[model samples]
Target: MRVNAKSQKPKTPKGFIGPIGFDLPSIMPIVFAIIVFFSAVSYSYTTVNEKNNVLDSIESSIKIADILKGNSYLFFDATDSGAKNKFASNCEKAVNIAQSKNINFAATFVKLDSSSSIEWLIENKESEIDSCTTADGKHLCWCGFSPKKFDSNLSKQFWSISFPVTVDVKPPGSGPEDIYPQSYLRKIIVVVWK
Candidate 1:
């Protein structure tokens, strides 16, 4: 049952050849609708990706801060020079973990200070917006704000609300005593972004 190729024409895919080829007004609305649909999908995809990235950063930062709580020195003896040094080292560890996970974050130890050098909170300002001008007189300051952002554009989108978390560890009796000599409530605020 051999057939001659020249006798039969090649078949075209189903939608390629309409009865009326390229009808302008009739097809315009359909083309416009397809374009609009694709554009909307593309926009939604990018938006979702950006939001997911931001959330990833926040989660990574929180994890880093939580890791610090497991260690006692940062919270218990914040005023002690040794404890302060340990806290700084822990912050570095957080940064390293962020780098490995491709997240940008700044974690800090914040404590309340009655004598902060920052202008006293405005009368109408939220109570959480207090200053820490002399906290420990050393490693940390500015109350609960995040460190300055490395990129200006990124900074615009930073999630920077400070909240206090529990630090159950007690200050070591052997830590520097004259430097406050007692434990104060503290917060480990972690601001993360992609």
Candidate 2:
């Protein structure tokens, strides 16, 4: 027995310290959970970025519309007929400017009240006068016109002619000729920017 004890090796530590007995199953669930958490975080970040881009586009369109409205009102307020004519001519120039800057615009003169909703005023043709009354019953007439041809892509045609707008207008009696009726004549300009 003493001779055999030297030949045989002592029993190795085989409980928790043995490589074959190590538990890999205990670590797998923790690794899977960490992977799932990172996936969810990435998805949420992508969704928020897309929403912000859409909001920014809408804001830019609104700003362009405001600028177009202001320029139209100032042109209509000019004193001389030649100046008004020049102003009307400048609509094309404005369109060119916008096009150069890569902004989309459509201009139209809309009547406050009319039997027909959208009447396109033919260039070089006189506009048909229609009776219009304000909320307070001020008697007026208006003619709708636009210098730029209607392009389906940029124009938002769903709006009403009576849409309320904030624009300064010279009173009917101030100018040599009344470019606009006493009732507010708002030029509704719609913008769509890509």
Error of 1 at 17 (Å): 20
Backbone collisions counted per model: 0, 0
What does the lDDT read for residue 192 in candidate 1?
61
Give per-residue CA lDDT, model 2, range 1-194, as digits (tens).
35787558766764656553455676677789889999888988888876664565455445544444444443344233333433344545555555665544444445445333342543222222232223343322222233355456534432222223433344433646544543344545343443
Q: Name the weakest run of 10 consecutive residues (lDDT summed) in model 1.
A: 117-126
Per-prediction TM-score to the true structure, in the order listed:
0.54, 0.37
lDDT of each: 0.50, 0.44
Cand. 1 TM to true fold:
0.54
The local lDDT score (0 to 100) that residue 171 gets in candidate 2 is 40
Cα error, candidate 1, residue 189 (Å): 2.0
Task: Name model 1 segments beyond 4 Å from true.
Answer: 1-22, 71-85, 112-154, 161-180
